[model samples]
Target: MLEKHVCVLEGVMVSQDREDFFLLSNCGPKLLEQKGLALGGLGVASINIGLGGKTLVELERPAAYHTTPIFPLIRSDRKRRNKTTYWRRRSCVQDTRIVIAIEPSESDGDELDLPERCRVLKLANSVTYDRMEKSLNQLEKIVLPSSDDTPNDKFLPKLTPLVRVLMGMAQPSEKIPIQELKFFDDTLNASQKEAVRFALECPELPVYMVLQVNTYAHRSDTSTHNHNILERLLALPASQSGTKLKVTRVGHPARVMAHEGVLDATLEVKANRSDQAALAKDVKNELEATLDALSGKGKGAKGKAPRGAERRKMWEEVKALRKEYRQREGGVVRSVLSESQVVLATCHSSGGRQLRDHNFDVVIIDEATQALEAVCWIPIFKAQKLILAGDPMQLPPTILSIDKMKKAKNTGGTPEKSSTTSDKTGGR
Candidate 1:
């Protein structure tokens, strides 16, 4: 017998704006149903705002009316067989897979973090979600990468635990939420945690956590620089094994690490050296100052800080020491390293770490638009399924040509060609 059941993926991209959210939840199901798809919905939330303390918005998506919720879909154990339907937003009609590219109003920045799976198709007033889907249908003729890129080697060796006790610390009154801890815990399964714990405690093997922090603070000299981000990250609370963690700023000169003994640091080689040099020098100096401030807190130092200050200082230093080295050798190299049997870089400046020997199950990239197209291919080669998320409109490729925009705008201009004078002169 044929069966039709409705499954709702609840809390998917929950937006703070109740109005905009209601549109998203209802639009899809209503459209699907009108097309004869066997889907069902209760109603466009039936509640009204009143003078009382409670608001009508609180009554939406009532638990009693809600059916069993579907969790975010993860890649199944089976290998992905087709690229066309590799990541169908939802299954339907045999001809094409539907992808909804919601371009929320610019005012909705704080609404929620859009799910990583939703690709930012474009940024234009007329390029609504439906138009974007149509554009994708036309682009179906193009080729895309396969669903997964997981390599065979998945062995994580043991690590040594650090015996170094933290010098100073201040406890926050508020409890740290489980959600924050879950960020680290959810990455690995039970067996993986056992392996990670083993590796962190193994003194012989170096283990480090990598982080990229973005501070939206403004700077006077550099228009699009993130010196504050580097500064703030240098002050974050972090602790790890005794392995010497190091922080290297992106856009720094390739040879800077070589000079500092933090060799093999990844850097994206782009134009504009003046800016890169300034940013690099700023990052290096900030790191040195942070470390000195942290180390000086416990010991006797002139103009000593109070206990609270000392605790914050120590936390920053521990974090600096726990850094895992990062090389933005562009997207490709990062991708490749993510799935290497043993991670390695060209310069064994960090000892004889080999790239080909390391491997990873997943790879994620932010601010992806700044990277060259080639860099994206590297990780696709090594990762199981690469999650590339970024605002493409924020910053585009530096090498783009004017001709590329010819068809982008709806300008009514026609191309003018030079006419030959051979009509009268018969000149060749």
Candidate 2:
């Protein structure tokens, strides 16, 4: 069954007096149809884009009154400035009863003619919403235009206009699953190890993290170092037969390379196990016998040598088997990510638009203090629970300009700085 979601319009409210009735006469029906809504159902005749001013007019035919009130769809002109320029050309529909004010992000300066019991919905980019919400006391709700309530596989692709429309209306879920938090310290003291052990003993999915470093080079190397610990944790239980754990690594080249090394080492260990050792011996013996027979040197061998045709066929079969084995091993490595219970990714890589549909049960961030707030939000948004490990006092985020700080202070805005320490520290 197709799910129905409640839609809400937010942002700057623009109204036109009786003199501007011509602005919305033509586009009202077309715009509503495009967004899969009925204009007449909402009693909307004309619409406008922009901010400021309020003038109401009675409609010829009002919508059928219902217990649940329906608000008008308010669209904003992308090119319109948020401040300074008043009397800007925008479109708005005329409605006499129930004035709907679309409070935009930049409507701080403009006075809104809000209804007595109007709800303020704050629309924001997924990463910026939390920071923006801290300062907004009037906000009754916060909406993420890039997110969806549907499951990851069933959700629409990100950045599509339809996705934006759907997300604007969908309600966000508040339930978060119980999970565990773990810290990975390369050189852990006894107390730290004991703490990790206690955390792991809990009845929940564990989140593992490492320490934060000042520079990207150090952080990348640390990720690699900690991955070794993760490997050991996986290997301890997997030593028993018929047990396996899948893990995915997302990070810089150094971290990935480190993970590959661990994979290779694990494969080697499996190859040398007792059961595999016996199989290897049997195969070696069979191959030796076959070679001896082909050369006419084995006991009770009748033929002088294998015919040229038979020898070629045997070689081809052997090559085919070897190729098949390599392909099977390669497939195991390639399929690890999709089947993995745990996924590891660098902050920048995690924030990629391509990963928008993915959801993690738990997220662990290492060296989080050095990470920009924006970069941190990408992973946080997708996880049910998050565990961050870092010493904020040791390595603060690097800021490039005092002018940006001044501007931020003057405008009461967040500092506009690069989200990664690597950029400021001159590391690729």
Candidate 3:
């Protein structure tokens, strides 16, 4: 059977929610029909997407709805404002009983509507398309039951005690087999080194490596971690085997250059800003020099009225130069990455898998603990022995911590209602 997954991307406006899910009911009245992968058949999982308003609630018919819940999908303050505006007067369906609660526009907004019992998984919000793709690829190996109680079959393995405790499997960690590398020190040991070397030797596939940087001086500096890691990896001693290593910074300026004729909106705009800044500085210098020269020439002149026209002309010339410079620098950088066989990737770009067709024989990951569980899996699916090297003690993955959630829910208010609800349900 094809592997299945019931991915819960918890953003307020996921891509899946944009489409009408009623389309699926065309084949069967049961939400969990022939194509559904619900386990044990007690309850079924369905794709739920919505914005702030009652319209989305009526449209999605979500399992539940709440006013106090914060949607991750809408990130911008302007968008959040728009959602509130649209939801305020939208008609609510009496039958739907869509509960809408208004709460503070902060992270605490998520607290009010916390599901008493549900697996609340979290993923990195701002990750690269490549890293996200990779994580999905690795997660593809672990089949998730669509419902809490799915019937056992070829697709649904009989739940073991350990599996039962896990509740539901997720990417990166779930996909990593028992024998794969474990959490270890910052530097690789003998076995880790040999495994990396062996995998890199595969002749037919591309060798991929990721260095996840945890320490960021600034938001932008976080992106530079991958580049630094790639540089260090390439500097490592070459193995006896004759496999060439290449590094590509996905979405980097050099990477864009390699792919001729394809223009990325993000990259194009980034290049323009850099060019414009340089052009502005150069023009300013030129204007200052022209002003100094003109002032020196007219230093002792009795009436500098004639010189005023010359100065005006010079100013116009400088202005023209500035305009010309802006135009010349507006184009995108043609090249983004180096020509090496090794690859360096960052958390942002590494969120999804960009390479395909089992191109990489061996995948190396650094700072695996800080990586998104889904993002970490992308490289694993393509490579044989995933060499995950990181310090788990430092930073954890971006996944939601149930411990933190429970603590927050109980700390501020009376936990009686939620606790009683959990007790009745026997805890999820």
Model 3 clash number: 44
On TM-score, the stronger of 2 and 3 is 2
Q: Give the poorly placed runs of model 1, Cα more than 4 Å off.
A: 1-241, 244-254, 257-358, 372-374, 385-393, 403-428
lDDT of 1 by residue, 65-118 (tens): 211111112222224532111111111111222212111122122221121221
**Which TM-score value belongs to model 2?**
0.34
Estimate the TM-score of every prediction: 0.23, 0.34, 0.32
lDDT of 2: 0.38
Candidate 1 local Cα displacement, residue 184, angstroms = 10
> Which residue runs does candidate 3 get wrong by more than 4 Å?
1-222, 234-245, 254-340, 347-354, 398-404, 407-428
- Using TM-score as the measure, the top candidate is 2
- Candidate 3 structure quality by residue, lDDT tens digits, 37-71: 11111111111111110012222233442221112
Error of 3 at 196 (Å): 7.4
> At residue 266, what lDDT does model 3 achieve?
25
* Cα error, candidate 3, residue 337 (Å): 11
